[model samples]
Target: MIELLQDAHFWVGVALVIFLGILGYAGVHKIAWKLLGERGLKVQAQLDEAGKLRAEAEALLVQIKAQREAAEKQAALMLETAKEDAIRLGAEAKVKLDEQIKRRAALAERKIATAQAQAEADVKAAAADLATQAAETVLAARIAGAKSDPLIDAAVKTLAQRLQ
Candidate 1:
């Protein structure tokens, strides 16, 4: 036992045990454990914060996607409305054009009727003049060397009655 007590390795081991006991009594291990626990809590808090930020980012992405879809729908509706308006305008223009064409055709027909009426009047007047001249020639040839005074008096009386 005396030889064991004088051993250098045993003395070193005893010294180490005494040092550890003194540290325990001084509360150094407790302080180290508390610091390690606080560090672990801080890391956990950071991880929770990161998770919250990631969730917020995902929510924002969903909101942006919804807004984009709404905008696309609005644009499509506007495009459809524009197409409808264009078609309506085209129909209205065609109606107006058809009305104008019909009006022009009616006007042309009226003008042609007036011209035909005028032409008929002119032809009738010419025919009447030619018939009167032919009758005058036949009368002059047939009554040659006849009683001119009596025939002239009778024709004047007949013309006066017809005029009235």
Candidate 2:
């Protein structure tokens, strides 16, 4: 190792290393600052875009607040309208129910009147039938003891034929 260090090849290697270091520094570290100017331009553009976005966000916030208030007002109005509609509907239902009750009462009264008329007609028909049956029975009893059987049969047969 000490022999290599003392050799001329070692000095040549040192010279090459020094030249590469100078080349790297000169390329990477520029004094003209073109890269610095580009970085500054990029930063300025970002700041301008940020300022524009901040303004837009503030405008959006204002619009959102206005929309929220408008929506709240509309909801309140809708609720009020619904309440009024409910009240109106309830009143209408009451009116319709009252009308229905009156109609049903009238129909019931008519049915009751019809039933009474029918009952009176039935009673009259039953009374007439009873009178007819009673008259037939009384006339048959009066004629039964006085009449001869042959005379009665002849007379009854002739009367039945004539009636038919």
Which residue segments of model 1 deviate by more than 4 Å? 1-41, 87-92, 133-147, 150-164
Cα error, candidate 1, residue 68 (Å): 2.3
Model 2, 44-105: lDDT tens digits are 99999999999999999999999999999999999999999999999999999999999999
Pairs with steric clashes in candidate 2 = none
| Model 2 segments more than 4 A misplaced | 1-41, 134-164
**TM-score of each candidate structure, all chains considered together:** 0.58, 0.57
In angstroms, what RMSD does candidate 1 have relative to the true structure? 5.2
Q: Judged by TM-score, which candidate is best?
A: 1
- Note the clash tally of each candidate: 0, 0
